[model samples]
Target chain A: MEREVNAYKCRKCGTLHYPFRMVCKNCRANDYFEFDIEPLPKRGKLLTFTFIHNLPAQFEVARLGLGIVELENGIRVTGQVDIEDPTLGMDVVGNVEVVRHDTYDDRYGFVFRAA
Target chain B: MRDVYIIGIGITTFTRLEYPLSEIAAYASMGALKDAGVTDVDYVLVANMGSARINNQSALASAVVDTLSLTPAGAVRIENGPASGASAIKEGFMAVASGMHDTVLVVGAERMREVNNLEATDFVATLTHPMAEYIYGVTLPGHAAMFTRLYMEKYGVTERHLAMVGVKNQNNAMLNKDAHLHQKITMDGILDSPEAFTNNPWVAEPIRFFDCCPVSDGGAALILASKEVAEASGKPMIRITGIGQATDTLAVHERPEPTDLMAVRIAAQRAYEMAGITAADIDVAELHDAFTILEIAESEEVGFFEKGTGHLALERGETAIDGKMPINPSGGLKGKGHPVGATGVAQVHEIVVQLRGDAGERQVKDARTGLACNFGGFGNNVVVSTYARED
Candidate 1:
């Protein structure tokens, strides 16, 4: 077992949302900011990915792999891809780890690998 | 609503400039004012994205107004990421259309070249979701490249099709004197030949250097006037017939169908409805091709072609300057240069040039009606417009 990234579920509609928002998208007929914290399932399938050779100034790498992954719980999230040869629809498991190293500190995000 | 007409237009060369951001905007504003034969405007709207962050300049509209000696005029800068140009014009359109102002000057300018390549890339990357995408170091190219992978598989599109778009837009740019990157690139050199790897290296896999628009520094201006003021200006009556805008999920991965540009579709439909016309009625167009694939993808999204069939239209030579319904004759953002703030206004500038039959060698034949698509962010925020020659 490892540390988990959280997804907020609407208390009213039971809809799941990541990178939480002010209002619930599915059903807003309930109290504001009423959401349940749920641990996101890490096992998923790779959707689409790219190996970016042109990177931002912050990333200290010749190239970086990034992708959108569909989690086992049906939540899709963008994460760093560490897989050597990631094909679309391939099984992947995510781990919460440091994805960026800023001047101040390291930023934690999902990093995916072949399951 | 009162009729709003484009009485005058102006633009600076789409290339690196050694001028200040305010000066660049003022320079274009002066050109537009002189074109309209007016010394003063009722209101001023400046469209800029990175003036403060990249150029270390803030209150851009105030700076430009004072620099042009247009003091005491109410002004503000409209920033909508890459769609700032069209968004400013949209505001200017409202000002005049609502009878609040008789004449409004809208200018879109940016000096992204003021910073180093790394900083500029990060600046543009700010459009993505910070917690979800940016923390993953997800740049715009990376986002587009991932979307392109889905497109290639779902629609049977290939690298050759992507290269064709790059070839057409870049070559079309040579005809535009104001466009950046005047160098001629061929398919053999960029895609087919052994030296292709050296010539068009990957910026993001599936997207080569040629596929992405160059980081440009430039400005474009437009003068929107009420019918009475426009009649006095004596320019070809180019009426603003339609304006439509829509937004989707800010994060690209959040959308149910990742490759589907729902905002583009919805925005264009609204625009067409406002103009009382359909896609087939458009004689010419300027689509936001920040990346080559966008031109193809947006064509379908905007109803010019069926979904996933835009590439087929490209293969049929239907999107060329001489082909049926020519798109991006001014080289689009791909060739013309994409100064984030200026791109939307520059798109309209080209369309107006076409509708007025003043586009010279790049003009679409009998272009009585034209459309411009100003895309913001990664298909999240979009503004689509329709323009017509009204005698």
Candidate 2:
């Protein structure tokens, strides 16, 4: 089975990184490890946003919405958003849903939703 | 100090082709040699900015040398992000000027169309901090959009301002046979383009699809020779009066003002100091317009206009071919097509054409002095070169 996606906390700096990193940027240490993968908070506010009209075939269904959101932990992360209005400093949050399922390929990604 | 002169230049039409990267370099090199009237080249400097991302291959210089069958010639590849072409030119200029070689060839090429759009974007994101910016999915357009917002909010330059830049460059590109997107642009087309307007959509808040340069595959080359060799060859020479390079922090947040590209200013000042001339003395110029806002921002940074006035100057027709100071007569990166590494060398080629009064229809009238600027990775690295037509 494919591994579930989750945030990995830096052992040295307590910073959380999506995807993954070999080293913590803040502490400059090679101690990127997580004991238990916890679901990230799905509700937050939008820091800034852009409406991407032209996108690759995968993202063409709906215009791509790129946004930076402040997580409940005060961590700012950039991700895809499905919100209508992209006003600055708007409330946004992450949703634990498959953004797009490549049926033939079978891959999924996390996307953001306005709370 | 020994003097260096660029005697010849050549560029292939920017297009999507099935040719290998090395093959493209060979074609451009041969054209440059023909332009220089040289049978033997002492050294070759290769510039390719995105081969690794496009093909998962690196070390393009050796491939070029083997393809060209230039045995025992010194060969090196240079990378300065998008400014790879100008960076290679600087290396070749220094090599000849320092008496390391009598004649040197600088060629810049890239094949981005070979990859899919997502792959290309991913490749460019490698230029940023992998852990910080790339993981955040910060695309190049995002950076330009951020700059556009800052310029608009701070200087009152609007989307209309950027569109005007597109309109002028597209019109000029129509005159350039070598340009990639040669179709003329109207202000309405820029403002109301299907891909940029309400029906079309926006990419980043301020920048739209039309505001960006094309992902093109092309090659451009220039031959540099010592003053003695250039004069003895009996070929027309475009003197390289000065070349200066400077770098700033890579991250956008690190800068004091994201809208102002200070590296361009410092580099241009150094070039002017060496060439003993100011921006006003330049009759023609080719600036890296990877995005519309880049042209305006770099122009202001290079002291071509007062801050926030670059858009006004473009609207006033001061930057057209017939204007007092013509910029990007080659259609700029927007219209001429930007192949990353090829852009800087192409800029120099356009300057040579302008200085020799050989640009044909788009020639800047009485262009005696010309300047070219190329910036890499959102103004992090910059190269400024000055050229003069010797009487």
Candidate 3:
């Protein structure tokens, strides 16, 4: 599993976007630079969450918790959360791990855990 | 622009039908042609999504037109995610309005049940952002769950409110023979009973099984004609008074405020302006309710109520069939079923039926002006249309 996630920052407007964008939405600039984010903080707050019982065939888990976590950088990203009971605004921290494995390869993604 | 009117409309029952995709479209088209008492049209527009991927079929318009024996007429397909139906209707409206075609036939169909539920879910997930949302396995219900969570925190909308919408629409569907869900669901059976948890499990957090629309297979068709052609048919004049469409960012996180549906607002505003009317003037409306929360959010976004107060209107029974201003009287996507591409045209079909006083038990009394909102891609692409009966 990758230890850190990658993001792109638009050089002109200082907008940080994950999964990258060619043009800056704010300033319409085409300049950007890629950088690996430091390990997510040990603690963050959950914006909202859902317990997904019905999942795609690729994910073997019977049920999974998915939520949007607001990192200290104020960037919100959708990730799987490892929590038995999750409440809005609950503190969570990023845990880089293998989320699933398909016929091809093991897939790694972020799963937030209660601090 | 010349005035356009709906000469006829037809829809198939929204359920699993073991038929070819082209056959579904052809069936609905034939019904509409018979309703209009016309054997030929100047053009044909087919609205479909996932035909190539799920059904392994392309050139859907040509197949449908040929099957309907409407060959030699200009035919094309429209794919706009889930909003394809309304988009094609808008195109038909333009064709008639611009004098390009005196009569146009618009048909929306989808055979999503060709695949299993899992494959169907994954196929629909393609509408999400490839890298940001889809990569992390985000589905429509997941997005709606988060959106519902935020809406609840901001507006005090509880689970009861969501259940209310589900029960209301599902019950309303009892009166609609063509609706997909025939089993009547009540708050007690699906919500308050001891077996409720098992009866309605969570598909995504905050969004339960009942909160979602069934993946349906169906088709709906409408006949659009210029005023002269429509008048000659001796049918009730249901004029296409307004059309408005707007788009938003491909990714949901990019929006300045994730909670605000700007596309819906802009599209509805433009439609109202073009129609020379306001929200208060609508006697009935068919807002896309793929998720129960959407009916509430769209009601406010379309100016039916103030922001954060749509649930209040629901609490007051104002959105019921007998309410002051009825919404989703045809049971909406919740009960009527959502065949993706067919949903938008089905919405129009329901509104036209209501406006014509042919909606039977579900008819909105004294209905004259109606509105239809066809939402696509989680509020990214929205189409709002207004219709009025000319006495």
Candidate 4:
């Protein structure tokens, strides 16, 4: 499962919490009791973006490429933009890739790319 | 509601010092005790936004208590991003007003310099969306800059307008002996200096290094007690008549207007309600100017002026210490230094000083009632406090 996107489902309230959550914010269900959910919508609109001249040494290769996007479903996420010309309300899509040095071996992380 | 008063406040120099965080906190605690003319205290509230990131430790409450040698009493640590200081004061005020303790010491300290700049930025970024913002790499200055651009585009504000905020606060800092940066910088100096790497180098567009607050290592403490205890302590009593707090979405983009901080509005409304006064009743204020634009925006958000009028307020000297409402007399975060968790407490400390007619050169004449507004993480969390002299 190198460089693959993952899903998270809230055990209580059935509200899916992507990435992960200590407990469902919607429901104070302490026991995570993990389960699978549909992959997050790939397409989104760029709510805002920033150009980082400085970044962590490990993320140097991805310099000036990070931003946050609001999915059509209104789920906001941060990821790397594949191209320049980033603007507010610009449409983008998700991509799964090995970001290098994943905390979990053989795992890929979700990143954003220009649609 | 029982009457509660903030008797005295003390703060260490805000600078890039090498002193241990514990020592800095102790000095502030002792200074506050001395200022209030008290020795023993019932409760101690510590506020530190992120010692886990700075020192990789979380025993901040125990550290302050042990350093001050105040034992067997209630002690707790409060964490509310940059508003940690104000949040701790809220807790201390409630505890004493509720008759839980007669005297309480509230110390807010942060040793941000312990970590390098990048690490500190990263740690602060954690206050943003963990998986959405930080994991993808977003710094707070970056967010503020975006909002700055939007605010300018909509409100027709300019860099010159933003620069005035730095200029005024820097001038105020010059009068503050313990300020982190006290040099009086002209708008031209800020724009023309090649050495001003962060000042103009552009950490994020619209928010230069000069616009942002310093990553400082310092501490501030306040002594609070019931009105009776304050009377017995022989210190000038600055009553906490109104205290209000509110929250907004953690993510900046989720806010109704990236430029507008509604959290401040909500807190201010509640504070005014609690105090039974309007914004017009305020004699002076110490705002959370973590960034220069924040001072402008927060001033408006808290009803000091109409929306989109904050920039003009700065230009017309309405925010000057001698103006209609003196803002940031202690130099603000821009010049005084933003020691994260200590900022909110420092705001209260400055208000208490001004209210007591003890602010010396920076004092606002005929000061009676003082207000402080401290916000955390782009107004995600906010605390507004109002203080009045017993006179």
What is each predicted model's overall lDDT from 0 to 1?
0.91, 0.79, 0.89, 0.81
Give lDDT tens digits, candidate 3, residues A1-115. Answer: 4476556666665667755667766678744433323344435788888777777888778877888777777777778888999888988888766766657876666789887
| Cα TM-score per model | 0.99, 0.83, 0.95, 0.89
Model 2 Cα lDDT, one tens digit per residue, A1-115: 5333466676656766553556665576754353335555666776556665544444435456666566776555556667776666677656544443333643444467766
TM-score of chain A of each: 0.92, 0.71, 0.83, 0.74
The best candidate by lDDT is 1
Please give the C-alpha DockQ score of model 1. Answer: 0.89
Displacement of the residue B80 alpha carbon in candidate 1, Å: 0.8
Complex DockQ, candidate 3: 0.54
How many angstroms is residue B217 displaced in model 1 relative to the true structure, after the best TM-score fit? Answer: 0.1
lDDT of 1 by residue, B288-339 (tens): 9988889999999999999999999999999999999798999888888999
**Candidate with better TM-score, 2 vs 4:** 4
Give stretches of model 2 more than 4 Å off: A1-49, A53-115, B192-201
Sort the candidates on TM-score, descending order.
1, 3, 4, 2
Q: Clash pairs of candidate 1?
A: none
Candidate 3 backbone collisions, by pair = A50-B205, A51-B205
Error of 4 at B237 (Å): 2.0
What 10-residue stretch in candidate 4 chain B is worst by lDDT? B192-201
User: What TM value does model 3 have?
Assistant: 0.95
